[model samples]
Target: MESAATDNTIWYVLVVLGLIYLIVLYRNKRATRRRKSRRFMEGKRMHDRDN
Candidate 1:
């Protein structure tokens, strides 16, 4: 019975960790995309100035 409880606790911990990992990945991807878009906008501004 104790082993069963331990297994359940481990499963819960794994699920929580997986969710945290996914959230971190999503935030990182969003940050990278935002950075890329900002860079693109800066380039466009330079092009406009050149024109």
Candidate 2:
């Protein structure tokens, strides 16, 4: 019975850690996309100015 309880606790911890990892991964992907878009816009503006 005690082993069962410990197993449950471990599963819960693993699920919570997995969720946090996913959230962090999503945020990093979003930030990277935003940075790329911003850089692209800046380059476009510079090219336009040159022309």
Q: Which candidate leads the pack in TM-score?
A: 2
* Model 1 TM-score on a 0 to 1 scale: 0.94
**Residue pairs in candidate 2 whose N, alpha carbon or C atoms collide under 3 angstroms:** none
Candidate 2 wrong stretches, greater than 4 Å: none
Model 1 per-residue lDDT tens digits across residues 1-51: 999999999999999999999999999999999999999999999999999
lDDT score at residue 36, model 1, on the 0-100 scale: 100
Q: Write the per-residue lDDT of candidate 2 for residues 1-51, one digit (tens) a residue.
A: 999999999999999999999999999999999999999999999999999
User: What TM-score would every model get versus the actual structure?
Assistant: 0.94, 0.97
Residue pairs with backbone atoms closer than 3 Å in model 1 (clashes): none
**How many clashing pairs in candidate 2?**
0
